[model samples]
Target: MTSPTIVTAAMLAIGDELLSGRTKDKNIGHLADMLTMVGIDLREVRIVADDQDAIVEALNALRSRYRHVFTSGGIGPTHDDITADAISKAFGVECIHEPKAMELLAAMYERRGMEFTEARKRMARMPEGATHIPNPVSTAPGFAIENVYVMAGVPQVFQAMLDALLPSLETGTPVLSRTVRSPYGEGDIGAPLTEVQKNHPETSIGSYPRFDGKSFSTDIVIRARDATVLGAAETEVIAMIEAIGRSREKHQP
Candidate 1:
């Protein structure tokens, strides 16, 4: 039998405001959920300030290691918006005023009775040979060059760009997950959980603990690309939980 194809990606969030905690990041989680649905595993995420050198370094590193690199923020019309330039530097290409981008932004501004100012025209700049990623919410579009996708900082615009971008990209078999909740602490099932993981090497097992004011509980999630493997892993996890519960019951007075 042929092995399942695994598509992996990394994320780079660029902005000084993000690092300063002035603006909360919402794109990372949105991208994670959306990428999973399309069978692209988000393996790593990095946040860098709006510095050209920093963006270039992080972009190079991420694009080299992952199959795809999705970047958000810094692709705007302000001085700090240097994502496009940094991407150009990383790929050793020239940044230019892409004709399609200019046409779209010019028309939008004209329709709105707004002057196409130099700062606003900055949105038309893109790395050479990059394809536009449509921005439904705004006239300023994002771009995809090679494996890296440069998107907007705004949440609505980022999501809209992603919606437009996903269809054109290749996808693999989606990953499936099963959750088993138990009213026992993670500490109580640590050893058994490890054993279960060893038994099911194909599935990834994770234990998340939750506290509800008075009681502690855990949620065990098993994820795999194959349905049968996921089901078998879930069954073993349930059996481990039951055995632990029974052992505690027998020892209690």
Candidate 2:
């Protein structure tokens, strides 16, 4: 048997702006796609305000449920930046001044002719025992502790940090996916769709309903690592969809 390995992750977006609909969170989608390419499963994503209680609760829950938890936002120079402290409280550790983070921030500020004020110094603070996640786009760095990977609020900076960090992460066998679309409603093929998944426990069969105003159809997708398994699953799916085609329902599936 193939060695068992699967890396699961949860994404946490922290900020009042995202919840208020003032800012659209684009990091989750980017993160999901990036993680998928690297064989890491994006198990779940949580969005919360810049509240200490909320951050603590979310971090604790995700850590318990998923193998990896990624938090974005609340790591800025502003007064509302409090992610580090909340994380510290959750892990029962002290939020202390991180020397490596300080050095990076100091050198970055010096180059940009910016003052490293008390507010700016907050960027250097992280949970004790957490390692820094380098931010190539901006000076403020992200940090990782155990399975939790804390990142920046800014989308651009967060993506840069992810690029630098994801490559080194241990991953599972890359999941392969294939989608087949037909002019058939999900109800027409739901029964056979269920059987295919039951028959092939290793493959997951998904049916997505779509209405293009002119017609309705279901996009059947099969996901699995073994190529042979995926092919067998797809064949069963197409045959089932074809069997459900009615004279009036496009006569196609």
Candidate 3:
């Protein structure tokens, strides 16, 4: 029998603007896809304000609940960027200034012929005993404290950090996925999909509806790790979808 390998992760999107809906959160979807690709399920996502208390509380809550905790936002040069400090306090570690980050900042300043003030040096601070997560787009970098990963708020920088950090993660067997499109609506296919789920208990089957020019159709997605099982389920799904399509085709003039 194949051993079960399902891991859970939590995402903490920090920033007052996101919580206030002043800025829409995009990190969650990216994180969800990336983590899922590595077979680590994204089980929880929380958006918190820039308040220190809120950050600390969210950190504690997420870390305790999942094997991996990923945090995005508020680690910039601005004063409102306090996620690093808040998380460091939550973990009882001092936020130390990293020499590598300082060097990077200094080099950037020199390259631009600008004075590297305390504000620029501000990017060097990270939690003590933390390892830097590389930013492919920018060198300011993020850090990882235990299982918690502190990432930048900028979408491009955050994506870079994830690319660097993901390879080092303890990933399970890659999840295999298949999607089948049906002209029929989700409600119409629900019963058959439920039967498919029952037959293959480990596989996850989901139905999503989309609108075309004239009508709406459902897309059935089945995901699982074992290739053989996924193939069997996929075959069943395709047959069902084709059957629906043919029926619709015959009905149309």
Candidate 4:
């Protein structure tokens, strides 16, 4: 049997606010969901401060390891928004103000009756040989250099940029998943579930515990690249739950 094609990706979320309690990150989850829909498995995510060295180091590691690397935050016009510079350093290139990006931002600012100040011009800066990722929400575009896509920190803008950029990327087969809910807790099914997982190597079985104030139960999620394998594993999980139920009933006097 032929193995399924799997395209993997990693995410770098850059900003001091993210590390601090100032700003909550919403872009990471959005990116993960969107990438999964397009068949790009987001395998890892790292959050770093606005430090240039940290961003460069994380970017280098992720870009080398995955098919794609997505970065959010630290690409704005402010002095601390240093993602562009970090990316340039990572690729050993100079971050310059691209003429096309400058033009786009200038026009948008002109229409908004705002001055395109030196600070605003900083938004046009990108790594050498980088392509612009269009930002429909804001005219200040994100950038793509090689495998890394640097996007905005704002959730709305990040999502818009990703939506525009996703069509150009190659995708693999989307993974399928099935969930089986059991009234039993993890303690009740842990041993058997481990056996089920070992028996079916092709499927990934994850057990999540849920609480409803009164009691705790388990939500077993089975994921696989093939539908047949996924369904087979799901069936085994359900059977295991049923057997546990029967055992509980047998013990009741």
lDDT of each: 0.93, 0.88, 0.87, 0.93
Candidate 4 overall lDDT versus native:
0.93
Q: In model 2, where do residues sit more than 4 Å from their true spots? A: 1-4, 244-253
lDDT of 2 by residue, 91-128 (tens): 99999889988888898889989898989899999999
User: What lDDT is obtained when candidate 2 is compared to the true structure?
Assistant: 0.88
Taking all chains together, each candidate's TM-score versus the true structure is 0.97, 0.91, 0.90, 0.97
State the lDDT of candidate 3 residue by residue for 77-147, as single tens digits: 88999988998899998998888888887998799898988876778899888889987686788999899
Worst 10 residues of 4 by lDDT: 1-10
- Candidate 1's TM-score reads 0.97
**lDDT winner, 2 or 3:** 2
| Count of clashes in candidate 3 | 0
Q: Write the per-residue lDDT of candidate 4 for residues 1-253, one digit (tens) a residue.
A: 4688899999999999988889999998899889888899999999999999998899999999999999999888899999999999999999999999999999999999999999999999999899999999988999999999999999999999999999999788888889999899899999999999999999999999999998889999998988999988999999999999899899999
Ordered by TM-score, highest first, the candidates read 4, 1, 2, 3
Please report the TM-score between candidate 3 and the true structure.
0.90
Winner by TM-score between candidate 3 and candidate 2 = 2
Native-to-model Cα distance after best TM-score fit, residue 211 in candidate 3, in Å: 2.9
